[model samples]
Structures are given as structure tokens and as C-alpha cells.
Target: MTGTREALDTAPTLDSRRRNIVFVTIVLGMLMAALDQTIVATTLPTIVADLGSAGHMAWLVTAYMLTEAVATVLAGKFGDLFGRKLVFQLSAVIFIAGSVLAGFAQDMLTLIIARGIQGVGGGGLMVTAMALIADVIPLRQRGKYQGAMGAVFGVTTVLGPTLGGLFTDHASWRWCFYVNVPIAVVMIALAAKTIPTVRPASRPVVDYLGIALVALGVAGLILGLEWGGSEYAWGSPMIIGLFAGSVVLLAAFVLVETRVPEPMLPMGLFRNRVFTVCSILSFIVGFTMLGAMTYLPTYLQYVDGVSATESGLRTLPMVLGLLVTSIISGNIVSTTGRYKPFPIAGAAVMALGLYLMSTMGRDTGIWLESLYMLIFGLGIGLSMQVLTIVVQNTVPYAQLGTATSGVTFFRTVGSAFGTAVFGTLYTGKLDPALAAALAGTGIPPEVAQSPAALRALPDEVSAPIVEAYTAAIDSVFRWVVPVALVGFVVAWFLREIPLRDSTRARATELGEGFSMPDSADRVDQLEHAIAQVLRREQRKKTGPPGPSVRVLTGGTVPETLVWAIGAVHLRTRVRGGATLTGIAEDHMVPVGVLEPVYREASQAGFVAIEGDSLRLTDSGAQQAAVFRRVWRVWLDGKLEDWTFDDPADRALLDPALDKIAGDLLDEQSSRPAFAPLTR
Candidate 1:
């Protein structure tokens, strides 16, 4: 194995207590970052009242998501370079700074800029948090922990709007951002105390030009769409120039990706029909979900005459519907391995739900509105839950990291584009509709912009303003119906390939439902494949390949004694030093029981005792290396079914395999602890 792949397995191990603490700390950091994504939804109206640019409402979401999507890519690269602990802490600080700036903003543009800053930090938190998991958690326990972490995203979706409303209603809208400050401060403090500093084993090439051009290109398109009808005429030079410039930059981005050593997004993955169709469907899902989430609160507030808290409460039906179907669909996919039907059904139902919502008017009852929102949420859940799984199942192992991040990247970009388009549609329609309704009544347009202010007006006066708001919201939902239908058509083109056992095992994880920003390295992906192999063997009650080990090691060392030496080596490498008591404690064995094994090894000159520390001698190191090689041979046999056609992919697999071989040896060294140990 090459040195680069050897470094892939370099991670710091902690005692169970410290590991759990660090886990909780990073999880808190992730929760705060994710909550910011949707917390502003219910507060958009009140934010407009203070900052006073109603047309810029979508930018609050667009800026955060756009920068966040860019940040996840860069952060993943940086985490591999600077160390996740440093990146995580820096992210917290940046998030706090952005939160402070946003809390004290004087205008809409300032708040939007601050949100962009927050996005950078939040993106770092999200990506690094996932990376940190592989660094600290034991591979045996990683899947369960990852599934729990995935549930956090689902919880945030349900909580963000309601929490934003509570803060907006009782204290102030600024509290939504302000709340992150103290929670983040506590998280930073806890993280510093618990997380170990583990640097990368090798350097990774970052595609700086590719990342920059794509970011700029996407931003340009969003800008053109946002400003087209609202800030500039659709045919004016400003909007037209923005649109023309974006296309050129995107073209350049594709060109750059082709030449770069390691592109942020490999242009080659699009050649696969599965990846292409999934990317489009992922985009539509994000477009519809975020767009509706942003404006639905606005509709409930202005048209339905509800408080911020009430609006947030009313949006729960959709969130709940999404949560239910997400979990259900993920479970079903795991059991049946048939997934193509979900995206098709989900997109069709989404269109139906949007059409139902567009039909809502002043007289629309709360029950009917709830039902519409529920249908929309269910469709989103079904469509989105499987996109990542399908991509992972079909993409080459070498392209696993890029392909996974690419799916999320498109989803986030779609969210920004959707919000921009939704905003343009809303403001363009509302300006004219409101003017027509208020012209004869002599009411200033500004008075009707604030939901609370409009609610105080006489029934006849408020009725027209309400109708105008309803019409604008109706137009926004109606316009997206075709987009959802397009997703329905695209879903048909997604080819159903046989699911790998590794991918199927992953499907059982509930986190697949919530669709958070996922970035996994090649080593991590290899480990995932190995994990499934081990799980299957466990179920079959497979025995160890003891005779194979004996043959490979020339019968010079007993397998258990080899394991003893390897355990000491692993502990010394990971924990700085090893002691008899520490090793015994880890394995739930008494010092008396472990004393003779080390004593026998020491007598054989495999280990040397210096005071309380145990160190592997030259002979012991040689024996452990032999054992590792034997284990590698066994792992190769167990995983022989996974054959890569490309030599480059095979090359990537070798190093990751080398790393996993060493890890498997270390983990197996502890296996004797589960049974009665016989020296």
C-alpha cells in the first residue's frame, strides 16, 4: 500500500467517556448551524418591518444556503489539511461573529451579507462534524452514531420555524440569530476541552479555481433571477448582463473542472444516467421545499391574519408529513431494495399538493390548508430520501466523495435559485395587485406590508390587502407546479440498478431521510463497505480464519499472542503509551488476568516494560507486521467480490484496504475479551 492510503487510517482514539463528550459537542455545533437554515422562515415578515426591503426577503435564505453550499466543499478540503478541531473552532467563531452582525444589522442588505458570513461558518461546522465522527468514533459503533446524527436534521426541520416564531413573537426577531451566540459559546468551550487534535496523514489537492468559478456562476444566476423583475426590468442591461455573465462563468467552471487535478465536482459523473437524473430531481426537491418553507409562513401571517408564533405552528403539518414519509420510505427501501417508484410518486404528489395550495384563498379553512401542506411535505420526503442512496450505489468507489457532495451541492443551489425565483414572482405580482386594491382606499402600500399592521385595519380595508397577498402567494406556488411535474418526468429516467449490500445497509439509517450535507472521504467509504461485510459475517456466526493466520505467520507466533502485541502497539500509537491496567480496563479484563499474557510476551522479548509504560520491542513490531499482513490477506479474500475495472480505482482501493487491514487487526486484537481468554 502507498503511504497516502496508510495515512487514511491515522485517527486519534479516546476513552469512551471523552469520545461521547466530543460527540455531543460537535453535534451541538451541527444543530446550531442547521437550525439557522430555516429559523428565519417565520421571522421574514418581522425582519422586513425593521429592515424594510420586502423584495430582499428571499436573500436571507438564498445567501445563507448559497454560501453554505460553497462552504461545505471548501471546509471538507480544509478539514483534511488544518485538522477538524481547528476548523470546527474557527467555524464556531465565524458563526458567532456573523450572528452578532446579523443581530445588530441596520438594513436588509447588511443582514443578508451577515447571513452569507454565517453560511460560511455553518458549512464548516456541518462538514467537519461528520468528518470528526470517523476520526474519533470506533468503526464498530460508527453506523449507529451516524444514524442518530441524521435524526438531528429531521428534528431541526420540525423545530426551526416554530423556534423562530417563539423568539420573534415574545422578544424580538433578532433573538433568532442572538440565540445561537450563547449556545455556540458553550459548544466551543466544551469542544476545546474534549476533542483531540488529529492532523491529516496526507495532503489533498483543492480545486480552488473550479470552486470559485462555480460559486460566482451560481451567485450570478441567482442575482439575475432575483433582480430581473423586482429591481431591474427583465429586458434591462443589468438583469440581462447578469444572466449572460453567469453562463460564461459556468462554462469556464466546467472547463476548469476538466483540467484540475482534483475538481470540486468531477464533470465525468454526469455521464452516468443515474447521477444526472438524480441531480435534477434533487434540485427540484430543494427548489420546492425551501421555496415553500420560506413563503408559507408569509401566507399564514398576512393572508390568514395570524401571529408569527401562530404561523410557525401552522406550518408543522408539512414538516410532520415530511418526517413521517422520510422515515417510512427509508425503511421500505432498506427492506425491498426497489426505489425507482418513490421519486415518481413523490414528484406527482408534490405537484398535486402545490396545485391544492395555489387554490387556497381568503375563505380557505385551516383544515384544508393543513391537508395541502401535508401532501406537499410527504412528496418531498419520498422524493428526496433516496437520491443520495441511488447515487452512492451506482457511482464508482473512487468518485464516492465527489458524487455524494455533488448531489447535496445541486440541492442547495436549487434552494437558492428557487427562493430567488419565488421572491421575484411574489414581489412582481404583489406590487401591482396591492396597488390596484389600495388605490381607491388611499392606503399606503407600506401599511399593508406588515402583517400585524394590516391585521389592525377595518375588515373592508384589510380584505383587499389580504386578497393581494393571497394572489401573490398563489402565483408563487402555481409557477412551481410545472417544475415538480418536470421532476416527475425526470424520475422516470432514473435507472434502477441493483443495490449493493453496503448501500442497502446504509439505507436503513434514518439520517437518509433528512438529507443533511454529507461529505465522505474515500477511506470512510471503504470502511463503510467493510463494516457491512463484518455485520453479515456476524449474523452468520462466522469463525475466525485462525489456520490462515497460522499458515501466513509460519506458525512462529500464537494468534492470541500476536493480537496481544498488536493491541499494545495500537494503544501506544493512539494513546501515547500503554499500560497493563489501561488495556485491561478497555477490554473489561482484570489486571491479574492480563498480567501473564504480557509477562509471557515480555519474556519472549516482544514487549519491554519501562516503569508503568509498555512498549513494543523490535521483535514484537515485526510480529505485529506479520499479523497485519496475514489479516490483509484474509480481508482481501472476504472482499474479493468487489472488483474494480479501472486500475486507478484499484489503486485507490489498495491504500484504503491497507488502512482497513491495520484497523481490522487492531479491532480483532480485542475480540478475545468477549470470550474466555486462554493463554
Candidate 2:
């Protein structure tokens, strides 16, 4: 990942206009997908009223959601398998088609199906947008871009309902669908031109079975939640069966992924400590974001009697806070190249904000809402992009795409689950409140309390229903506080590894690039020299392998060439005493090589000859000991294991000793035993 940054730094910079164009293209593409999610919520009433089927109102949202949830995982896999750009563009096309179809839908069923198609596209857009940003931006600069993306999300949240309401009131509600068409077309064109193409270094085989299991598991779980207690009783066999099936399928998916050669989700990525921690942090981020964002506007609209437009407008404070902080944090991360501090601080701030917001009631002031939203936004801005940067920087360049996509997948799953759980809690709270309020007010207890039943009522009947919703939504925020606090705990484990120089020298030293020098080269050269010397010494030792020669020397002189030449001569005469037999055996050579030279020395009256032993004269003994001492010092220094006791060390020492002995013999054989040795 640091390599990516180094590459980017060396690449030519784009002009302001080109950079803006690229940013705007991605932002608009992101907004189209993000805004479509919530825009339909405000327009749902008009659609139901026009189609006269309030019974299927939730399905309008549920279908889009279920398809989207499934799409996120698939898109991530395909983005990695193919290229992110291709999948992203393809998603845009699918979304545009869905938008056009929804705009002209003839019935609620058609519209819901169209929305599902749009969701398939939406999932692709969301995942690919992130992956593409990661591809181009260095880890240092990524936070700023991520922050900018967060701002786009904020803008979409503010605009979605407002635009939906405008379309519902001033024009046909279908225009809400049409609004995406032009934006989608423009984004597609810009993306084709500006988005660089990238392919994985090696293609990993897609796990079709695992993909099926994942999609089925997520779909079943989402369906069971969406329909349980509404379309069917919570205890109904169909709902129970679906939930059970979801668990089984998901378990199978995990098992299958583990054994696959190249699993869509690499299990190894989780082994990285930083990646693991960041993934947990991101999951909590998603949980908190979805859990809180899902309910805040509902509380404003249903409990506080704010119009859809007003609700959207009221969210502006949160949006503004998020936008400002996200951009600021991103820029800071880019400049500093450090990220650990942000997640820690951000999680703490977010937890504080949630804790404060959880204390709100029906009488809570707008100013308080604004304050909580600002604080919450700041916390999100600080942590969100920075965590992404942390995960990217921690992994290898080869695994960058997988690591980034894996975190994204977990976060999205968390968002979906958080939304489901929070929605369940909100509705669970609303049911009893509605039942108590409408018990004696002439409304059927079941009809007054039900989510689907509440939507079916006239505006006059829905007022109390909205009141019930506001209380329920506020109750959901109370639950979000704990989730954010848990996130804070996880953020503390994030490790901070310093980014260092990106040079090849540093990379090689750190075991990242080049292979080190060979260990056997010097050893090989020493071995060959030793073998040649040993062979020559052996030839001289017994005169072509015949019987060993006995040598006699006079008392006045040193005997053999092996004893009186080079290092051997110097060591014997100056430092240590030596016998001819000791020299042959200690040096691992034959005495025949020394015997002839000893006979010559005796003939020259250099050493005393005895029956079993030769006694060196005083001068000869002194010279012999000095020569022996020098030879021993030279041999001991050259032997590899003369200083160590290991087997490998001894093996190295053996070859070195042989070479030393051979060199000494060769030098000695060239001159007289009494010749003075050169320094």
C-alpha cells in the first residue's frame, strides 16, 4: 500500500478542472445511489394512495433494501474478480434502467420490482465507488477523499426527502424516480472517461456456491425480518423456517469459504491484527450510523409533527456537521500520515454524542437536537475515513483490494443488521404506545397498533399513530448509545505502526524486495584451494604413495620443509616447539614428506639424529618452536571453527585447515629448511 502512495507521488498531477470533474462525477454517482434509498420513503404514501394498496407499502422499501443488501456482497466479489470500473459502470446502467422503469410503473407491484432492480445497481455503485477511490488514492490522501464521500452522503440525506416531497406535491410522485435518470447518465459518461482501468495481478476463481449461500442467507434473514409480525406472525412457521434456513445457509457459507482455493473472502486477511481490529471498528461504525440515522428523521416527522420536507431540512445540522468534519479530518490525515489517534478520539466523541442524544424526550428542544447531531457528525468524520486508511496501510499491496473490500463488506452487513434490529425495537415500542392511546378512542386495537395498519389509516386517524412513532423512534436512539460505546472500546486496540521511507534500499533490507547474498560462495573458494594443496602435499609425502621415508637430521638445523618454511617455520622457531611426527599428524599429512627433507638437513649437520627420535640443537629447537608457533597461529586463525564448537563450524574449519597446511608445504618445498621466512 505504501508502494501505491510512492507511485502516486511520482505520477503527474492533474489540473484543478480535471480533478474537480472526477470528484464531482464520483460524488454525484454516490449521491444518486444514497439519495434513492431514502427518497422513496417520503414518496411511499403518495404511491400507495395512487395505487390504492396500502397493504404493500413496506414492500416498496423492503424489496429495494433486500436486493441492495445482497448486491453489496456480490458487487465486492465481482469488483475484485473483474475490475471495479466495469462493475461500477454496469451498476450505473442497471440503476438507470430501474429508475426509468420505476418512473413509468403502472402499479405498486411493478414499481417495487423496479426498485429491486435499482437496488442491484445501488449496491454495485456503493462498493465500487469505494474500491475505485482506494485504487487511485494513496493511504495518506485517502482520508480526505473518504471524508469528501461522507459529505456527499450528508448532502444526499438532506436532499432525498426534500426532493421526494417536492415531486410528490408539485409534480407526479414518479418524478422522484425520474430525478435519478439525468444524474445517472452524466455519471456513467464521466466515469467511462475518467476512471482508470485496473485488473488484479492474478485472477482468483470466484466461489459460485459460496456466493449463492451468502445471497440466500442474507435474503432469507432480511425477508424474515421484513415480514415477521407484519405479513405473518412472528411465530408463524414460514418466518421461523426462513430464519432457521438463513442460519444454516450462512454457516455453510463460512465452511465452504474456508476450503476454497481462492475464496471470495480470504480468511487470511483476518489474521492481520490491524485488519481485524479495523474491521470490528468499521462494523461498529456501520451499526451506529445505521441504527441512529434510521430513526432520527422518523422521530422528527412522526412524533414532532414535522413535514417530510421539514424533517429533511431539520437533518441539515447533522449533515453540516458531518460534511465539515469529514473534509477537515480527511485533509488532516492526508497531511500527517497518521490514523490511530482519529479512531480512538472519534469513537469517544461519538459515544458521548449518543449518550447525550439518548436523553432526549418529547419536550426536547430543536437546539439540543442540533447540538447532538453536530457532535455525532464530528465523531463520525474523525473516525470513518481514518479507519479505512488504517486497514489499507497495514496490509500488503497485493491484498489491498481484498482487505479494503472485506472491511466494507463487514460494515455494510453491520449496517443492515443494525437497521433491522433498531427497526424492530422502534416498532416494538410503537405497538404498545399506539394500543394504549387508541384503546377507547373507537379504533380497533389491532388496527391502531400495527405498522401496516397505521399506514392504512386516513390522515386524521394517523395523527396519534405518528405520535406513537415519534416516541418509538426516540426509544431507538437510546439503544444506539450502547452500540457507539462498544465501538469506542474496540477502537482502543488499534495499533500504530509508523510509515517509513519507500526506497528500494529500505525495502530490500526489510525483506520486501531483493534476495540477500549467498552463504556458500566464500566457503566454496576456500574448499577448492584446500583440495589442490592437499593433493600436491600427498604426492610429495610418500614419493607417489610408496613406503614412508625415514629422515635423519644433525643437531644444528631444522629438518623438514614442512617444519621450516612459511607459517610452519616461523611458528616453530619463534613461538612453539614441534616434532616432525607431530607436524605430519597435526597438519593431517604424511611423514614421508618431512623424512627426506630431514635426511638432507642431517647430511647438512642441521639437526641431531637418534635411533627413534631426532633432538634439535639449541638453535634448531628455538627456530623450530618459533616456526611451529607461527604456523599454529596462522592455522587457528584460518580455520572457521577454531573459535567455536558447532558441527557446521567444524566442517568449515576442516577445509580451511587443509588449505593452510597445503600452502605451508608448497612454500616449504620451494626453499631450503634454514631459509629465513618473509613477513
Candidate 3:
């Protein structure tokens, strides 16, 4: 029992295989969260008609977003309090339960309540999934993972309506909710197997007061905007009071945050110039991406006369543009170790694209519209992934979850407000234009208001309304130009902190300091295994002669190949590390040649040489582990008939086996030519 308990308490680690599986599982949860955001919209009319609850149709979406807004922030804090894996699994169960209930809901109210439950679970999935990657993956490898996950946003953005439409048309609308069950089951199973049980070492004080205030503040602000001009007049007492109360609530939340220990959003984070700047950029990016995407499809449907699914399909250009740029920018940042350029360029491009979109009118060709979308998407693509990465780079591991969630929270709020404000502005322009078009004409108000009714009208009646709709949408885009410009200006002030390589051991980057890889021998074993697997796959390809394995047999080292093999040898063979001077003596090489050899190894990221001491970097250590595995595999075949019960004989054979392994690599493949072992 003691052994079991100790093992359970050990720090969690995973090799490449486990990491990949976990990543996929997390994406599945994210897809479900994103899908729910838009999927219900396509089936709303059918849902209302079937349930006979037309008055509450909008609540189906509003309730979900409202709860989701609160859940996103709360989940991050709770994950910090409890273990992330526990919270993540609980979220899956809750989301699954919500799906079951939503599918069985008898009334609009029941469905709305079910949706709100799902929102809570979905928010947990989103925040925890993001935080888990930061926990397990080293910082250097995070860019590609983050980039690929960001592309999930693009996929969900385009596929949500399309998938919902197919389910509603082919099967019952309930299938839209039911479909999540299987996918989520698979996700839960994967997470259970692949996710480690990780808990923070200490539980911080929970700021319940601050949490309550932030939740209320966010709810009031969203409700105020969501209801204004639709449910209540902009000047109505209810709307005015909600807005005023929201301000007071938010101000109080700020005060509570300052006073509380372990505030959900630590005020001190804002003092980090990177966090502040990135949060603002994240908000603006969300504003433009969500706001523009929302109205673009509306134009396609109302004016271009496309069906719901066709509207989804028409937005593919933007999705593709966003996906391609997201991947490219991620790879660039990973390789170049620079991030400031992408946002600077992205902001400028985004502003340009929005300006171009504002110029589009009803008569714009489909190809021209796609081009405009592509440009806008390109701009969004460049900036969005970088914001999250930069913030992750800046925050300490302890505060990582909060900083990430904060960025996400602001983005979501910005999206909600952007959509509302854009709608308010568009409708404000549209009403006047619409009234003038209908004046002195025999069109009834109700028919003109109905999209289907308006479309059925003669060209003479519909033409002016289409023109008015075109102008109104264009005005919305034109108004958004300033928001993008603000982001562009703000991007200039963003400090370009050198993104530290997490693979290189640093006391500061690890929140627990020097007590990580050294204190936990298990981490060394896990790293060793992870490196072996990754190297086995890569070593299959052909390579030029690297280090000569014959160097083991007392041959002169080649100037050309020595650095390459010597780096690997130093990492894998130099066990129980000796000082620089001792290593020179052991290798029978002069300090002069070894100095340049160490320099090559350091530059190539194989090892770190601090003063006279030497140790492998994370990358170098992994490669050494690979070498160990290769040696083990070859040595196993040669020693099959031998028995070494004695330590003295075992010790003698170990050196012989290593030398033979080196010779095989040099003679057979002119490289480290060991055959890749089967897992």
C-alpha cells in the first residue's frame, strides 16, 4: 500500500505516444465545446415548431453562452484547487449528462437548462484541456501543438452549422445533441488512460467573494447587451439598470481581487507587460474573428439566397486561410524563436482586410468575396495563435492556468460583445434604410420583416431591401475598422521577451526550481523512454558518416565526423558526468580539440557546458537514451546464451557490448546505424 501510494504521488510524465493520444482526446473535447456554440442555431426553428415554444427560441443559445461565460473563468480556478485530471473527467461526465438531458428535454425551458449544464462542462473541458498541454509538454515543443489545436477553432467555425444541418435534415434534431455522446465517450476513455493525475502541491485560498462578483459582473454585462434592442429598449430602465449594475459589480470584483490571496485573476499579472498586451490583443482578435464570421454568413443567406448549409460551405475560404497561416506562423515561431513580428504584421493585415471588406456591396462577385475573406482570415491567423504562445512563454508555471484562462475569458467576452455591438449597429442602420424602402409602398410590416416573405416578393420590392441590407452590413464592417486599428497600434507596444527554451534546464522556468528532473529519478527514466521512441523513428532514414564507431577500437578520429558522433558519444557514453578536464583525460583527447568539440555539441543543442561542468540538455538526454536503447537491443542478441549472475562479469560485458554496438554503427551504415527496435 505504501509503494502504491508513493507511485501515485509521483510527478506525472508521458512519452511521445501517450502525449499524442492525450492531445487528440483534448481536441475532441474542444470540438464538442465549439460545436455546441453554433450547432443548435440551425435547428432552432424546427425546435421551436416542434416544442411550440417560439417565444424562448433565442434562450436556447443565450443560456448556453451565458453559463459558458461564467464557467470558463471558474473552471480554471477550480482546476487549480482540485486536480486537473479530476476536473477534466468530471466535466466529461457532466457534459455527457447534459447531452442526455438535452436530447430528452420536453420543453424549451428544459432544453435551455440542459444547455446551461452542458455549457458548464464544456467550459471545464476547454480550460483544462489547454492547461494540461502546458503541464506535460515542454515549452519548446508547444508551438506546433498549440497551432494544430488553434486550427480546431477554424474547423469548428465552419463545420458546426453544416453538421447541425445534416443531423436536423437527415435524422431528428435530437441527434445533434446525441452525436456528442459517442465522441465524448471516446474522449473520456482516452483521457482516463492517457491523462496523468496531477495536482498542485499546495491548495491556495479560494476567493469565493471575488468569484461571485466576477460571475455576476459578466452575467449582467452580457445580459444587458444580449437583451437590449431585442427584448428591451436600449433606454429601458431594465437595460440601463443592468448596465449600471454591471459596472459596479466589475469594479467591486477588481477590488476583491486585489484584497484576496490567490485571486482567480491575479492583479499582479497585469503588471507583466506581455500578459496585459496579449490579453488586449486576444480580445480584439476575438472581436474581429467572431463578429466578422457571424455577419458574413448572414449576407450569404439573406442577400445571396444561399441555404443554411450553403452559407456554411461558402465560408470555407476564410477557414482555409486561417488554418494555413496558423500552421505556418506556429512553425516559424518554433524555429526562429521570435514572435513579435507575427502580431505586428497580423494587426496591420487585419486592419487592411476589414477595410477591404467594408468596401464590398451586394453586387460583389462570389470570387471577390472569397478573396476578401481569405485576406481577413490570413490576418486573423497570424495573430491568434501567437497571443496564447507568448503569454504561455511569459507566465510562471504556477500562474499558467490563470493567465491562459484569462486570455480565453477576455476573448470570449470580446466575441459576445462584438457580435452584439455589430448587430446593434447593423440593425440601427437597417431600420432607417428599411423604412425608407417600404414607405409609400403597399408592403406590410410583418412580411417585410420575414426573410422568406421578403425573398418571395417581386424584384421591385426585394431589390431596395437587398441594397439596404448590403449597406447595413458594410457599415458594420466599416465600424469594426477602428477596433482592428487599435489592435495594430497596441501591437507596437508589446515587449518582445526572448522565448526561453524549456528543454534547456533552468531553475526559474520550473516553478519548483532545481528540484524537478534531479529530485525525481522517475522523470529521468520517463525522459529516457520518450527520447528512445522518438529517435527510433528518425534513425530509419539514411545519413552520411557521422562519428566513426571505430573510434572505440583505438583509431584516429576523423575531423569531419568527430563533432557529430562525439556529441552523441559525450551525451550517451559519459555517464555519472565528470568535469571538463576529467572528460578530456578519459577520452585520451587534448583539451584544445575537445574545447571545439564541446562548442559544436553546445551549439547543436546536444549538451550544455556551464563553466567546467557538463550535462545534457533535455534534447541531448533524449538522444542519449535513444543510444542506450539501441545498444541494449543489439547487446541482447549477442549475449543471448550468456548468464552473468556475478556483478564483476556483468560489468566487464557491459563495456564490451557498448564497444561492439559502436563498431556496428560505424561499419554497417556509416552512421549510428543500429536498426530501429520494435516497441
Q: Return the top candidate by lDDT.
A: 1
**Candidate 1, position 290, lDDT:** 93
Local accuracy by lDDT, each model = 0.84, 0.60, 0.64
Model 2 vs. true fold: TM: 0.60
lDDT of each residue in 558-603, candidate 1, tens digit only: 6656767977978876678899888877777778887777888899
Worst 10 residues of 2 by lDDT: 510-519
lDDT of 1: 0.84
| Candidate 2 accuracy as lDDT | 0.60
What are the per-residue Cα lDDT tens digits for candidate 3 across 1-679?
0000011122333546787988898889877987887787556545654674433544566566556666766665566668677887888888999899999999878998998899888878876776665556533244456535545745675567667657876787799899989998998998888888766554546667887887788778767775687668999999999999999999998998888766767788899899999889888987787677667766665677565566667777877777667767766675576888888888888888888888887678989988988899888888776776576566643454466567766776666667666766666677788788888887865555445566688887788877877788889899999999999999998888765433111111211110000111112222222222223323455542123234322254333333344344443342445355755554445666567766766787766878877767787556544544565564454334344455763564454345434433323321222212100
> Rank order by TM-score, top first?
1, 3, 2
- Supply the global lDDT for candidate 3: 0.64
Estimate TM-scores for all models: 0.92, 0.60, 0.66
Ranking by lDDT: 1, 3, 2
Segments of candidate 2 deviating more than 4 angstroms: 1-28, 41-66, 69-89, 104-112, 126-162, 185-204, 229-236, 331-338, 355-361, 440-466, 499-679
Q: After superposition, how far is residue 34 of candidate 2 from its true place, in Å?
A: 3.3
